[model samples]
Structures are given as structure tokens and as C-alpha cells.
Target: MEKKIADALSEIDGAGRVTVVLTMKAGSRRMLAEETNNDDTSAVLVSRGSGYQETVTVQELSPQYQGALVVCEGAGDPAVKLKLVEAVSALTGLGSNKISICKGK
Candidate 1:
């Protein structure tokens, strides 16, 4: 995702050599369910009637982005920085406050 954002930002007229770093609020977690097995394998394995088991990932869950740091040569200029901010915001669905632009080498 960061790579895609950086590629898009590089399309801006003054933007050059864009690098994007994303900060996430938390790592993705999975839901679990309880299951039991009465088969012979249970004799060797830990046999818990209501054993905890990992379930398929919840499709609705999405990673929450805390912020983004963008570095680009064009970010030194006010106009280019604003444009970069807008581009990042659009791609991340985050507000301007969550995006920071910095001058790059």
C-alpha cells in the first residue's frame, strides 16, 4: 500500500523520489472458536472438549492506520507539500493531520 501511494505521489509535477511509511494503531488479530475431536488422534494430542481454535479471519476487519510519513524532494515547497498531503490523505482515507510531508534528499 505504501508503495502504491509513493508511486502515485511521484506523479505530481514537482514530486520526486517519494517514500511512504505507514504507522498502524495495532497489529491484526484473528478471531477464534472452540472445537473438540473425539478421534483416536486425541489420545496423543491434548484432548480438550472445548478446545480453543483459530477461525478464518473476519472478512470485515481492516487495518486501522494511525498516520503516514512521506518524504519527497518536492516536499520542501509549500505548494508541493500541500499536494503531497492531499494525495496521501486521499489514498489512505485519512485526514491531513495524519499525514506528514518532509523534504527528501
Candidate 2:
């Protein structure tokens, strides 16, 4: 999954696009709070049963490129969010460029 994500990201190199992946716990308060503001970003929330099982939010951080698409892979684990961020950051050499996980319900 990481390789697939990385491959998709690699195509946008030097094209002025930034991609990020995020995972959130099911029915997390933090996740609910963040989902209040959703606009112009790509996000997905998946449920395994009755509640919000997990979520993956991807955001493209380049105004110059309007056609950019953010891809999110659901892992059902919040702990992997940091690792995904770090991996993407390292792979793209994008440091602190105002990227955020979109709010979702």
C-alpha cells in the first residue's frame, strides 16, 4: 500500500503538488471535531460496523495546480498517520508546507 501511495505521489514531482495521508480512530472525538470544516479537499471515512471505524484524509497543498488529486488509504489506525506524513514528507522533500487532514464525519 505504501508503494502504491508513493508511486501515485511520485508522478506529481516538480508539478507543484503535495499529498498527505491520515488515519483516525473510530468515533474519535478529535476526528469529529476536525470534520466540522470540510471544503475543497479529498477525504474518506470508512466504517467496519456501527460506528466510525477509521478514516483517511488526503489533501493537496498546491494552489497553482488545481487538478491535483489527493489519495487516502484507510488503515483503521491513527498511529500510522504520523508515519505516513513522515514518509510523504521525506519522499517529496516538502517540509512544513501547510498540510492538514480534512475534517470528516
Q: lDDT per prediction?
A: 0.80, 0.39
| lDDT, candidate 1, at 18 | 95
Distance from true location, Cα of 99 in model 2, Å: 3.5
lDDT of 2: 0.39
> What's the true lDDT of residue 56 in model 2?
54
Q: Clashes in each model (backbone N, CA, C under 3 Å)?
A: 0, 2
Compared with the true structure, model 1 gives a TM-score of: 0.67
CA lDDT for candidate 1: 0.80
Distance from true location, Cα of 47 in model 1, Å: 25
Candidate 2 residue lDDT tens string, 1-105:
335654654354231232434332222223221344556443456787977466654443321211112334422234444444455555444442433322222
TM-score of each: 0.67, 0.28
Over 4 Å off in model 2, which ranges? 1-70, 101-105
